[model samples]
Target: MKKLITYIVIIAIFITGGTALTGCYVSSKVANKSGAQLWGENCNRCHNAPGPGEFNNDNWDIIGTHMQIRANLTKTEVDKITEFLKSANN
Candidate 1:
């Protein structure tokens, strides 16, 4: 009976730890996605997104700052989208 209780406790700990680790891994993956992917997923949610060529790099920076606040984007998402837009502008 004591061995069974110990086994149950070990399994419970493994399950909880595994779940926490998995959550972290998934969040990191989302945060690290390509800039284009982040832009598509997040920016498009509110309205039509302009093409990268539609604005210069400076304009993009300004627009990104505004949209970042309006859309409540994470810092990582804002950085990725800004990088993607600048790259696409060229």
Candidate 2:
């Protein structure tokens, strides 16, 4: 009976630990994708210039709208770029 309890406890620990670690991994992935740096040196040549960490409520939506057309970026690229900009908290 003791051994059975111990085994159950171990399994529970493993399950809980695994879940917590998985959450951390997921959060890190989101941060990584959002935190990606937008290189103005290349990105700006075709689009209006964006300052790193400069995307605030004042300009993010507008910038996102204008950039998609000027850069001719696809929806995915636009989303990624906008996400990155938002993550910059500009």
Candidate 3:
């Protein structure tokens, strides 16, 4: 009975530890993704995602600032998306 209980506790610890590590791995992968990927994933949720050519750099900066607030995006994410849009518009 004592050994059986010990095995169950060990198994439970492994399960929880594995779950935490899996989350960290997934988060790191997302952090490394490019702005285009992030834009495609997030922007289309509300409105149709526009072509990068639809706006110039200045327009993109204005739109990015507005969207960043409404979408609750981090400043870093907004900057990456803005830069990608500006580059692709050319």
Candidate 4:
């Protein structure tokens, strides 16, 4: 019983730590100038200036697919732009 409790505690700590780290990374990514510029140039061309949550989180995947078709972005650009959108949610 004690072992099981210890294991659960460890898992909880890891999950909490991971969430904190992800928050920091997302915040930094959103603040990055290159990311901001990319979003303005690429995303804003079509979107009104609301914010990421203007669409639901799942909508980002659909929007990214459309962007892939419309902009002919490389895989890296697509990934980075997706990350930028995700960061805005946090």
Candidate 5:
């Protein structure tokens, strides 16, 4: 009984640690992405991807705000995508 309990605790600890490390790795990967990469990955997930110059900065700002909610995107992602669009439009 004691050995079984010890093994279970060890397994639980490893699982928890693994999950934490994975989350950190994923977050770091996201942080390193460029605006263009994020735009391609996120916008295309729902409908067809829009051309970067399809809208002005103001327009992109509004769209980004909408998408942030509708698409469940992080604020950082939306900001990056919006910036990419604004720059491309220019």
Candidate 6:
């Protein structure tokens, strides 16, 4: 009976801990950030990013997709960065 109670407590702790950790992977809010800001915050954290003029809109889209995954960026961040690059490319 004592062992059974200990096992139940351990299981409960594991369940709660897992749920809490899961929140860290997901974006809590879509931040209102400029392209340059997002680029600096997310992209520059890992490596230097090329100037916006270096790539066309389509290229930015492709590169954004790849970087999104590589950087673990949220959809909102990807969209903002892509828009920023597109505007700056002009």
lDDT scores in order: 0.83, 0.63, 0.85, 0.69, 0.90, 0.83
Tell me the lDDT of candidate 5: 0.90
> Which candidate has the highest lDDT of all?
5
Clashes of 5: 0
What TM-score does each of the candidates earn? 0.66, 0.44, 0.66, 0.49, 0.69, 0.64
lDDT by residue (1-90, candidate 4, tens digit) is 999999999999998998788654645554554644676777667765346566766787787777889976545556667667777777
Steric overlap count per candidate: 0, 3, 0, 0, 0, 0
1-90: candidate 6 lDDT, tens digit per residue: 999999999999998998788656655443446778888788879888777778899999999999889888867789998888899767
Q: Judging by TM-score, tell me the better candidate of 1 and 2.
A: 1
Which tens-of-lDDT digit does each residue in 3-84 have in candidate 2? 9999999999998998788654645444444324444433767656666577685476677667678766545456666666
**What shift in Å separates residue 53 of candidate 2 from its native position after superposition?**
2.4
Angstrom error at residue 41, model 4: 1.7
What's the lDDT for candidate 6?
0.83
- Runs of candidate 6 exceeding 4 Å displacement: 1-30
Model 3 whole-model lDDT (C-alpha atoms): 0.85
Candidates sorted on lDDT, descending: 5, 3, 1, 6, 4, 2
User: Which pairs of residues collide in candidate 6?
Assistant: none
Stretches of candidate 4 exceeding 4 Å from the true structure: 1-33, 44-50
Quality of model 4 by C-alpha lDDT:
0.69
Scored against the true structure, residue 22 in model 6 reaches a CA lDDT of 67
